[model samples]
Target: MLPNYLCYVNSVLVYRSGGTNRLTGLMLAAGTLALLLVGPSVIQYLPVMVVAALIFVLGIDLAKEALWDTIGRVSREEYITIVIIVFVMTGWDFVVGILAGIVFACLFFVLQASRGRNTIRAIFDGSIARSTVRRHITQRRFLEQVGTQTQILKLQGFLFFGTINSVEDLIRRALDIAAWQRNPIRFMIVDFSLVSGLDFSAAEAFTRLQRLLEAKDVVLVFCGLQPDSAVGIALRSVDLWADNGVRLEVFANLNEALEWSENEYLRGMYASGWASARAFGRAMTGAGESGIEAARTFSGASGSDMGAHKPSTGSGAIPGLEAAGLDIPDSKGRQPAFVLDSGFENSPRRSHLQQAVRMALERTGGDAMMVGALNSVPEIEPENASSSASDAEAGLEGSERERTERRTASSGEQLPPNALPQPGDGQHQSHNQTAIQQRKRKLVQPAPLLTLTFKAYAQEDLGQEFFANLAPYFTKVRISKGQKLWERGDESDGLYLIEKGILKARYDFPQEEFEINEAMLAGTIAGELSFLSGQVRNTAVHAELDCVLWKLDGTNLDRMQMERPARDFSTFFRMLLRVTEEEQECLMSYLVTRLS
Candidate 1:
């Protein structure tokens, strides 16, 4: 017979635990040799041996990660029970050990099947290095903001007879805990949202879990259950959950389920939906594989310009699979699919590309007020603007003209545009009379960048008037890996920010050059001197990785003349400042200690 258990254990352990779970392979290899010498009896019992090894190894791993204090907090019976199960599985015949542990396994199934799959799907709040989101949002088209919680989790699959033993052990062990008693679970909702099919074994396992839960005063509910499918048929027409048993209301709509579940009576209830197609999609359908395995087939907007703010959305299109977050046409390119990105080498958005373009364009003619070229944006509330103008007219039409005349005569001189207006100069007041003209501030839809910090920043701080006007003037520039933003002595025309990919800023010394290493993470500011001075770039920016940056035109000399809020631009600056300050402080502390 094929070694079913060994096959899966070897395959799964390698993928899930990587090198940490490699013991199974070694055990299996040794077991093969043992069988050659010991004969069939030992070999017949091999499955249990592998399982035992698995439990001990897994437990050891868990212990390594566990807070030992919690071990004492649990009761002895559960611990002994766990130990027995592990011994039986690891020490005896694989088939018999598994068979002997059936009681514990049964208990496990009863508990797990009762709860089904109430999952935890959250957009991890922090950097990829610190969080799991980066692992899941690997595809180039999976437009996820570093911190945006737009990513979702729809739990799929089901628990059946095969996993029943695990279910029982989990239930029994959980009940044995002091915490469970102190904070008793009253209700649990199993989301069957994505359960397309169910088998009898799983059905049997579910019943056991439900019964065990109810015994502990915990009620079970099911959601998103499609009645015609196997799980549906098993649940709707079976034992522990028949019409006579506790009937789980299957919801086709989510809002209805939410509405019912929100009742005060259901306050202590914990229920996670079981997504069927949608749930499977979370694992299978998205733009990319999200680094986590089990989700293999993924899709993305590969081989296309993503963040290049083209009024024509066509430029944002990807050649194969379109990205998840862009506003590209819905029907073009590949259908919504899931692709896995193991390394975060490829960014989900083209923000870096766009940034690089804007930076290059800035040299041509840059704006300081706006981070990117500002397209004329009509006000959202035109009527509100008109009303405000009308209010100004009313304020001006009445005593203001006479007041201006009196002030003009008293001042006795014509005021220049550069002069700060007093109460009024008759002529200076005349310009206000023609109407304080309102410039339709260009509205540019900045491509929003999601950082690992969960903070989102858009393209170019368009809030500043200088950059606002400069945004429209911005153009596209491309650079390969290790290329500098500008060479030393090249007229300092503009500055660059990492829009999508990685970039670095280096200062050239007499013999060599040095660059800020980690401090120059994405969202960093580079070439500020070039934009500020009408001279050549003092520092050279080299792309450590293939990068894209927003370039502010060097020629837009008037853009940086004054500091304005630049509205939305402040947020990006704040992010850069935060990263820079933290790094600078570390350096300063080192310098102080060295000097002392």
Candidate 2:
């Protein structure tokens, strides 16, 4: 075969061999056999210089095909790598060059990670700043103010020595600014919810940061750490942070840690102050003036010469406390409950931190004063007086009561088609009491009721009246042990309020096994999210034990509106409107939380 013809045959065979072409294979084999037979004679006629030229041209073609297209797009570092590999391969060996290239790539990766861009997205107080999750576990106004005194540094990406160094500078600058502004921070929250990883070196940097902050009497809290994350590993391995005076706490999530920090600030800042308020209240009886008036006068003395010592006219005046206008008394002869009435009904009005400060000042012999801007306390009307009266009037109606009793008796164990159990139901009395007790225990150390959560959505007084009046509309449900009360992705049929026994919520994911998300005790409401949003259930709930539940749905509610007495139905309708309003708030909270 001619040299060009042989080359063409070789390339064709290489390309076509990949397919299932038996004919091509046979032809190639026959051609090769023919070449073997005629090769010596043909080669004898061919010139050696021509063969050399063909080989040289083929090498050039291969080189251009491999390298030319890549040259322009390559980075400077890649250029250096290519040069090094070429030199090493030529001077030493291909194997050595490949190994060297691998090492260079690894080194580049480490260097890039060390010098990566800033991961911090924000640094602000939860009190003034909104988070992606609109709700927090804690809902105390004091906690909100404490949030202002705490700094949340939301970080993203990975944490390493170099990145941690950058973080240190950021924190130091924040501290300096706080000092200059005269609003020194008491807590520093390092939020790592968005972080991809954390190295040991970064953990060490945090230790150093803790030490630095400790000197300034600041507490450092690390939040949103997963159990298996790198920083979590480092922190778990060392107990140095737990040693005396370190004050380092790690939390499973940002919200939990922030709540803890807020609680700490609240307790620490106001413990003594509360004692002082009580003492001041006690001393007022001897001064011949009402305690509330004395406090107001002391608070209103802001323009007085605060620096100079003034004679006491038995007014129980506290010096320099009048500037802030802190009021703690109500018309009712109850313990001074600080209420901030901003006139905006929808807003969360009072700051408990301010009240704590007032108490703290009084303890330190500083005048507890109220500022002029805060002098006008907003009038808070009784929340449910009219509703209570209406309900009471309807209860006294003998005919309606007799009709409800007959409905209850006839239904016997199964509820009437459209009716629910009323609060006065004899059968549910014990279960309801048990649920109430469980709820009361939770109240002792109240979970920071997320203003965005169910508890927050239900105003205490309104919720009490609403559920009481509306309870008659919910059908009683009994679930057996291990039985599924509901499943994830099920339709939003109704809301279940547990009256007795325990239930558990679990989450099931596509690629992962089921996980136990939470345990529901009596009095907890399940399916609130789904019921409000008209969305499918996001979790599955199973009865941990035999459970008694009150299930409320639209069908039953509508039936009551048509068949029930007008007075009772009107009260329930008002409650339904309130519940809808609260659910809307919850839905907004849910949406914002997801986006954040």
Candidate 3:
């Protein structure tokens, strides 16, 4: 056995002289067979000195290549290993030395592979590395505010028992900080896109991580796992991809995983914000049982019911308020003269009204504009009440009459029957009839202009002047729920301004499945990229709910440039540019996060 091992080693060394080619190995085997067949007869004629000199030369050459040539080329540890193996072969046995070398090679490889610190490439939160899905400005701001709640750890290189501990320690420290801050981490995303492989021990470490995250009520999300890949198989073997509700989620890519986490964050925020808003409304109303009802009514009307009413046309009235049973007048009309009626004196409801007003002012972030409205509430006098009523009755406009009625309703007063248009009075009856018909017409007519006072537009400091000038360029387009607005690669025709409802933009590629890239909310601009640049659409847009949009096509834009003042056209163009800039920045951020 010893002789056979030596023979095998000699053949390998001879093969090395031929640059390790298969043909050279074959020739060496044939030569060795021939030499063995005739060895006894040939050896007697050969000079023993010649054999010794050839062996000496071979040893010298091998030593020069292994020991001398490797001095500065290999690591110090590896160089030392080579020296130890050579010393063992010289002092002890060659077989023992070869075994020791194998052991050392493995030990060093394990030590180098298990350096876990480099395994985690980076850590990010929602603020810096957001999902590809674009949301409304307000929703984006909210995500930024609570970005720390979602932690992402991007991992790379080989993962084993030694390296996984570092990842676990990092997550534990993050969890500890979150607990201390009273904002526990909601989702911990472990991205394995760059990971080359992971061992069973590393898989078990992830299992332990899962248990810890579950105990802390945090979700464990895994992304970038190919189903047939070794890492994925190892993780799956540990039941990490089990159908556990809320505890674990797996996605194909980081973007999908991020989008899922973000959606969860937003959903929670919406629920909590609604609860807070309801509580605020109840406190303001100051009617224990009725306060709850009022809160519910206010929240529902302001939120989901906003789209129920038709948009106002030049009325400046909040469309849904009347439907919500709040009898407020149009903005163009005069303010209701709130006279101090007999019923209002020393009324308990007055204090509640004051509290409501004060609370509203506070909620508005204590804007100075509302301070005057708060102070003047108690100073309402009845001195000019009779004159105002008389004026309202004597052919005052229909909107004025409506305002008076709303004011009287709040004051718990009723107008005398004679105060209403008398049946026998021809002029008053005709005028009253005309007013009623006009009110009906306003309700049925489609609003000719977008309301600049909408929170989204108001944020841009747009006012009536901007609305009046730009509104004419937009044509209203209504889309039903589930209707597709445009498909990917479609020619860019125009940009859309969302007046009401939600639209979602989805990206689809031949290599990947479709994913929703953005949610276009009311008052946001959509398709601006393709519209402005004249490029083919990259995403398909569809209505998430019944939608009302104002579309501005190239034709109208060209007309506006020709007919409108340069300032107006420039202002509108700047707004489009700003929207494009914001979208680009968001896209760039997502791409950077993904690549990094």
Candidate 4:
């Protein structure tokens, strides 16, 4: 067997030296046949010393190639292995050397794989790494504040028995640190996108880790795994979801998993905030005071208690009456029935509570100036009008006073005693009536809804003038939940700005067997890439919730350019460009973080 292996090495050398065909094998066979036919006579005619010298030269060549030429070409460990194998083959048995080589290789591989840093590609907390989903401003702010509760471990390479221990230790250390800080981790996201494979032993290790996380009341979210993949199948074989009732959460991609974790975290936080607010409201309304017990009973009887009787008007109604264990009385006083309007028809229960709290504060003589800071109900002012009619009246009075002073200065005129008009003066009455009519017109005009979307995105207020000019170019569009705005490969007709609700864009790569999903919140623009590049859509967008969108097509933009002033159109175009640039920057930063 040892001689056969040496012969194989010599055949490889022959192939490297231009004998790369069946001709070499055929010639060798022919020589063997000739030797068999001619017997020992032909071999006796050949020079024995010459044959011996040829064999000696080939042996030296093979030895030099293996021992000296490979010295600088391979790593120190590999070179040492080679030397050891060569010495053992020379001094002992060839089989012993081969077995020794195999053992050393396995040991080296295990040592390299077990290194802690090599298994984890990157580690991120919620603050530095977030999902592609854009959320509301308040939700986004809250996530940033408590981002540390969610931890992400982006794992790479193969996971086997040796390497899995390092991953477990790293997670345990992170958990310990979090517990020490009094802000324990709530969600642990393990991203397996870059992982090539995993062994059954590694999968079992993860099951143990799951138990640890469950004991701590932490959720373990697995992402970037395909159900049909080997790693996924291996993981499924384990008792990941034991009879203890904790379910394992798995997502198709990292973005979706992260979004789910974030939503869960926010839901708990918001619920706690609501509970606190409810307690404060109860205290303020004197629900706990013994002296006010009778008053409370009387108010309850008079239907002044929240949700006791539906208010005829939209104002002063407590939001989420059912959630608060209260019911509004119907006309028959048997069933509960109520409706909320004043632009909060589709608002969440949180928004309703916020509005109710703001109204309560107003009635209790809370600071009006601090209302905006506390996420209070927005003042019922028109979007196009910066201030209310009362403000407009104040401005009119100031202008009238200035006019009187100007007339006195310019004409150098003094009012005669007869010039002092009585209450029935027609000129004064006409002027007063005209001013009142002007104020009424301002109050009655409906505001542009698209202005809300613009104000949310813009860093500073662009003012009513900008919105007034831009509004004409955009047409309002409403879509029901699950309705697709456009399919992939559709013509790039326009971009849609989300005014309300959520839009989800999914990019599917059939060949890759994975999809990238992103959520677009209100105030964000969708399909901007195709709109700007004049290309077909790469992603299909659908309404995740009932959505209100403002769309601007190329035709509308061109019309604006033709009909409006150059400066006005230019300003609008520049604003769009700025928003696109800002979004691109954010995406670039996110990609860098993930890739790094």
Q: TM-score per candidate, in order?
A: 0.25, 0.48, 0.63, 0.64
Candidate 1 residue 70 Cα shift, in angstroms, is 44
Q: CA lDDT, every prediction?
A: 0.38, 0.50, 0.59, 0.60
lDDT per residue for candidate 1 within 1-596, as digits (tens), equals 11224554456556665545568679778978888888887656558877777756655554443334446665554454455555665666667656666677566555654553442221111111111001111211121112121111133455455434554555456555574533333334454555555667767667777777666544454655566766678765556455564534344422223223222111110011112111222221211211111011011223122122212233323321111112112213312111112332243222332232333223322211111101111122445666644543444444345565577779897755455544355655666655433122222211212221112122433332333344443344557866766666777666654433444444455745322222243333455534544567665556655554556564433443344345534554454454444334533432232122
State the weakest 10-residue window (summed lDDT) of model 4: 368-377
Candidates 1 and 4 compared by lDDT, better number: 4
lDDT of 4 at 6: 66
Q: Compute the lDDT of residue 268 as modeled in candidate 1.
A: 10
Candidate 2, residue 434: how far the Cα is off, in Å: 34
The local lDDT score (0 to 100) that residue 128 gets in candidate 4 is 69
Model 2 TM: 0.48
Candidate 3 residue 383 C-alpha distance from true site, Å: 44
Q: What digit string (tens of lDDT, one per residue) describes model 3 on residues 1-596?
A: 12123454476457656647778767878977998987778778889997666566666766787889998999977987898898877778888898889899888777765666588998887778887554444345445655666788999988987788788888888768545355446678889989999999999988998898887667788898877888889988888766543357777888777766665543332222233323332222221322122223223223222122222434323333322112211112422112223454343323332333344434332211110011111211268645433333342344345576688889988888566545356756676666544432211102112321122323354433355456567777989988999999999999887655667788776757434366655545789889889899999999876776778898998999999989767776775686677677877887788778
Give lDDT tens digits, candidate 4, residues 486-572: 999999999987655678888787758555677776646788878988999989999877776778899998998999989766766
Model 4, position 545, has a per-residue lDDT of: 70
Q: Sort every candidate by lDDT, greatest first.
A: 4, 3, 2, 1
List the lowest-lDDT window of 10 residues for candidate 3: 367-376
**Residue 218 error, candidate 2, Å:** 3.9
